[model samples]
Target: MRQLFGNRAFVLLMVSDFMQNIGIWIRNMALLFFIMEKSNHDPVAVSLLTVIEYVPIFVISMIGGVLADRWRPKRTMIWGDVLSFLSILLILFVVLAGYWQAVFAVTLVSAVVSQFSQPSSMKIIKRCLPDEHVPAATALSQTLMSLFIILGPMVGTTIYQTFGLLASLISLLVLFAASAIVLTFLPSSVDQAPDTTESAGSLLKDMKAGFSYIASSRLLKVLLVVYVVLALGSGLVQPLDIFVITERLQLDMSSVQWFTALEGLGMLIGGLIAAVIAGKVKGTYLLFAGLSFLGLSTFVEVLSQWPMLTGTMRFLTGVLMAMAQTVLMAVMMQQVDEKFIGRLGGVMMPVFTGMMLIGSGFTGWYMSATSIVVVYFTAGALFLLSSFISMKLPISREPVQEEAEAPVSVNATVKV
Candidate 1:
């Protein structure tokens, strides 16, 4: 732990990411509330905001991944931050102009840029840290995100409630600018590889190579299948979570807020646990265990009406989710070649996003036709099924280890 924290580059990257995530979540909360108010609590209108945000991920994530592989990670990341900052500025102007609807467009633009930024950031982390530290690093990064999940809404809500939309936008602008500036000082290259000239035609070939590589790896194939299936379940839950808290729990909005806070706390704890046990334990086993826990928690939540029990279930759900994702990320980092991180991100993002979109749309109709509880039950079932199927894969029984020849040069300079 000390070693990981002692790295200057890691700490700086974490700080920048912390600020950016806070700004993004706060903006997300502000927009959700703004839409709810403007649409007079229409579920469809509110859900439409989520749809718009994810649509770009479905449309452009694969292309962005390809770009990430071709471009230097630092440069790609810096440009992404700049674009996000500009989008926030545009949203601020739209808010000032009383064009509430324009926020949707701004959100879409930010999400599109994120496809590039997210993969680039991953590439940097993969290159900067040693293979052994990847799990702890992944944990720490996720733990910070859990912290934001806890605080972002509270902070965003407080600011929005007090100072209004302009203040929120201004906060995002500052955060993005800070992130971009910090990113600029990072090393241009951590490892020197022979440069090769490639024509535009090579890009298509590269894309094909990425797909073929994933298809060829039995481990990656199983992981990808499980990932897409889980995304489908999460898609159903995310859009309808508020409804479960308000309608089923028979609680007010404050209850929903508290549930989120508790869940974040659980995730923080889970991340720490995952970090501690990472290299010692089989990540594939952890992944399946987390999925099973998620299913059990969801099932329990539906069976109980007591607020305390439901909240506890939610917290447990968060713990399971954090553990599962942390292990999954560690496994991916260890298994995939560092050179293909960008391409892997590209392939994975579209699969997750596209399935999620389909699930969310179907869930909306399913809820209208059946019941919210049924949807919850469905999610729980999918999670359990994912766990069972994952058990059959050989990767689940094998522990992850650093490759005999590490890809990233540990001695490579990371300026600032």
Candidate 2:
């Protein structure tokens, strides 16, 4: 871990990711609070906001992928951060101006732009890092992200309570600016571009090509399905957390914030575990174990409605989810060609995002019409189904190669 961070580019990337993640969490908490508190809206409204925020990623992720492949990843990331910063500024302006509806609209636009930025940033990391360190590197990145997740909500809630939403927006904007500055110093490399001669074909053909790539690859197909199910199942728990704390447990808002923080703490631990064990274990086995834990944790929540038990279950769920996600991402990075990483991410984003949207909406509706316990049971069942499906899929392992005679020069740029 120390050696990994010794690479300046990796350190820079980690710092930038950390800043942006902090901003993301703050913005997310603010959006949730704004909808639930200020707007006096229900879960459906929160779901709608989430849908609008994520729908663009589903729609534009492919375009973002193509662009990431065609352009220099670092430059793309810089521009993306710039746009995100601007968007935050716009949100801050609206909040300051007291136009709450306009703030929502601006927030949606900002989310769309951020979605476009994500693929490029991911591509840059893939390009800059060598194959061996990728998993640890990715784990470290996620660890930093989880740390921000731990801090952002607590800090945002405090700021919101003391200084109101406008102050929180301003803090997010400052963080975004810092992220942009950190990203600007990284190395740059363009992703592989599609052949111009093939560009004249039908749009459907291009779409089919992307789908065909996944279809032909057995491992990707299974992984994609697993993630889709995971997204759907996990989505149920997020919105329901608030409901569980307020309605079922009769806890105040501060306890809800603590629950979020505890979940982040669990995720940090999971990421650390992945980092330590990544080189030692087969990615597939780790993934399966993680998924199993996730399903079991969800079931625990369903059976044990006690606040302490439920919170502990949520913490365990975070750990399992982080392990699965970190390992999956690292495995995918290793197995998939660099040129297609962005597109693969693009294809997966919508399926995952859509699942989350549906899950959040379903949980909200279920909570309103039925009981929180019922929602937990349904979520657990879905997770179990996903785990079962994952077990049947063949594991795709990276091909082993002879060790390089010498360390690859850190400054050398490699074309994908």
Candidate 3:
């Protein structure tokens, strides 16, 4: 653990990610409340904000992924943050012009840039750390995120409520600038761009190659299916989670705030446990176990009216989710060639996002036709199905293709 923390690249990345998390939560909470006030609590406006945030992931992830592969990971990441900063700066001005609705652009710009930036981040992890350190690094990263999940809303809410939208936007600008500065210190590395003579069609050809690469890997295929299926399930209950508090537990709407906090608290504990065990465990098995138990636990939540029981189940659900995602990320890092990380994510994430969007759209109609209990049941069943199917994933830890013999030069990998 000390060795991993002392690695300069890893340390810098984590710091950058921490700042990015702060910026994200600030955007999420501050914008949400601000829009609620300006739009007079119109459900359509709120729903449109959600769509704006997600639609970019569905539309732009692949393009960003492909581009990320052809660009230096460090440089791509820095540019992504810089661009996000500039975009937010622009939004701030438009809002100052009395067009508060321009706040939606903040989410849209960040979402679009993240498609490019996030893939580079995965690639950077593969480049900067040895194969063995990846799991611990992922655990640490997940733990930081869990920390944010637990506290981000409070911080964001506090800032927005106390200082208002202008202050929140300015905070995001500083955060993004800070994140970009942190990325500047990462170990210098090269990407897998084609020769200078390559034509414009090279991007298309690269994307096609990416598709073939995914097709060739049975584990990758199964993983994509697992993610999409799980997304479908989670989407069904995500928007309606408050209903769990109001209907099942017979609690007030206000209780939903504290009620949802359990998952974040659970994730913090779960991330610590996963980090400790990740290196020793078979990730595929962990994935299966997490999902299966999480499914059962979620279903258990539906069966009880007791606050203690339901809250315990939510906490357990968070633990299972964190463990599952931590291991799965480790697996992907170990299995896919570093160069293909961007392309692979590009294809997989958008499909997963698309499935989620599709499922979310269908949910309201399905619930009206049936019942909220039926909807939650459907989510649990889908999770179980994804888990069972994930049993088909290969147990091999070997990469499908060898990565570049060395991407980061020795001198560039300065350890603290």
- Lowest lDDT sum, 10 consecutive residues, model 1, at 407-416
lDDT (10s digit) by residue, model 2, range 260-319? 777888899989988887678776676777788777777676566588987887788678
Candidate that would win on lDDT: 3
Name the lDDT value of residue 181 in candidate 1.
Answer: 93
**314 Cα displacement, candidate 2 (Å):** 3.2
Clashing residue pairs, backbone N/CA/C < 3 A, model 2: none
Model 3, 1-416: lDDT tens digits are 88788888888888999998999899888878978998999999898898898787778888888788777788888999999899888878887898877767766887899898899899888987888888888888888988998799899999999999889999999999999988887766534343455444456676777777777778888999999999998888887877888888899989987767888888888899988886787777888988998788868877789999998888888888899889778878888877688888898888877788778888999999998888888899999999998889885757876223433211111111
Q: Candidate 1: global Cα-lDDT? A: 0.78
Give the C-alpha miss distance for residue 171 in model 2, angstroms.
3.9
Provide TM-scores for the models.
0.85, 0.81, 0.91
Model 1 segments beyond 4 Å from truth? 33-48, 94-101, 191-194, 197-202, 238-254, 364-375, 392-416
Better of 1 and 2 by lDDT: 1
